[model samples]
Target: MQKIPYTTINGGSVPMMILSVFSMITFTSVYGFDSVWTEWWWTYDGFSGPAWWGTKWPICTMGRYQSPIDILPDKLLFDPNLTGVVFSSEKKINGNLTNTGNDITLFVDDVIVPLINATSGPLQYVYHLHHIKLHFGHDEASGSEHTVNGQAFPAEIQLYMFNADLYANYTQAMSSPNGLVAVSIFLEVGKIGNEAYTMISNALTHIPTKGQQHRVHGLPLSVLLPQTKEYITYEGSLTQPQCQETVTWVIFNKPIYITEQQLTQLRNVNKEGGSHLLIFGNIRPSQPMYNRLVRTNINFRPKTKVCSMVKEVFYEVNTVQTRSGR
Candidate 1:
């Protein structure tokens, strides 16, 4: 090679030293070398694909192993021994039916349940009964967490209880997977002649609209449970916001009836400090069925399938199918 001029650094002229400095600058991008290096690396055959980019930075995508699943009938199992369903007949408050934002607390008594067996593979935990309450909305079709098939019920009575002993409060039970269980009861319309109606109807006068408060007692919880212990059970999350995935849902197959006047009274309650919350409907769209299972206890009579119930009613009356085909 021809003789080359050596670069001077400090007090020395060293060719290798100059080359080392240049290489370092090239890699570090002290000059324009860093950009060139990045372009070269990114264009390399094995490193240029989307897979490589994804491996480096994952985006919002569902993972097959931990994807979200939907609650379906097949995933549920019914148990019969879980019976003695009773509705409370106590009415604790009486005031303006529309404005009263009273917290109606109902007690569940003699609910005998078993400890959740988490060691049993998929059916690890069995959710026990807890107390339930109502969050009133301003419409006939709203206020419940779920609907029968697709129809929204007038009011939703959320029976709250946890896996822990019935003595435990909601705060304690919600802390763990085995802590809480809620049975949701949807209130429908029409006359069924239930004694429990007096408990709620008596208080309607006190709950007029938003910002009103009423205090009452003696509301029974048993009146809301299905006559048959046969209920569809599944692993689900609380229907409220910040939906925790710890709830074991037991939705009664049978629905309680309410009068049109009673439903109107419920629709006038205040919601979240706003105007009387006119909740026309409250329910989530049915989700896709995953590989989960729903089981019912064997002691009680089997409940009619929700689909069949809808079909029978529609056909019996020869009711014209609405555009939505409900």
Candidate 2:
């Protein structure tokens, strides 16, 4: 097996390492810009595909555990034995934000880095937070990569982690079947903006053009995740070209809210090669689930409990009003 070379550096100084992990990487140039034209080549037109994958990128079309599947609620298996995720406590970590023309990525490095680790929850190994990537669409209506029971969201955020017990570096880990784990969070349009996303969003101004990057300080991983750990787990492949069937996916049940303006900013970011052309819909369409069983820890109780709670609240409020004689 060929080993991928990787290193850690502070202040956004490390050079981009090109590897066979993702085929679109071959399009990166010496100046750190990736061509928008090259990124568009691999994207599938819709939910199903014997994609542009077979002829050139065969693994994607042939891979059994392909990702971005439409998760059917009725099809999920309720697994009581699945352990809940225990993540490292929230803290600030130094990182860099960069635009690859297709998506925005943030890398967590070791400059005053806090120890970040997560265990259990369908994982056979402990994993550490490696980095983050954001996926969105050209329009507000349909940008998310993964859909819930055929419903698509405005965007999605993926937190990539490496099995610390197995491989020493993240890049080296992607080649193996159990090497990588990604926690996916869906993003919806709402009135309030998420403060956790501000660190990366603020940095976008400095790196508005493709291939350009800016170093970020004090990004807290704690703020980037959902308040609850309710998620659906399944085995799947990377959504990008040279799609490897190595990821253990954990898609959170609830979505974090962001404003419409913020969504627009993400859609309008420039592609690599420094063109004004905005890259829209940077997501792979849903693949076939085949026979994979998606397991979840959430046990949706019967409607009886919901009604009881509402009735109790109403009774308590009515009693208070009667006591006041109003």
TM-score of each: 0.53, 0.77
Per-residue alpha-carbon lDDT of candidate 1 for residues 125-224, written as tens digits (9 for 90 to 100): 4444434466544565455545444455566676655554432545566646655556666666776534566566666466544455454444434554
Q: What is the clash count for each candidate, in the order shown? A: 70, 0
Quote the RMSD, in angstroms, for model 2: 13.5
lDDT for residue 161 in candidate 1, whole number 0-100:
57
> For candidate 2, which ten residues in a row score worst on lDDT?
317-326
In candidate 1, how many clashes are counted?
70
Q: Per-residue lDDT for 136-190 in model 2, tens only? A: 8877657888876566788899988888788877778888859888899888777
Error of 2 at 290 (Å): 1.0
How well does model 2 score by local distance difference test?
Answer: 0.72
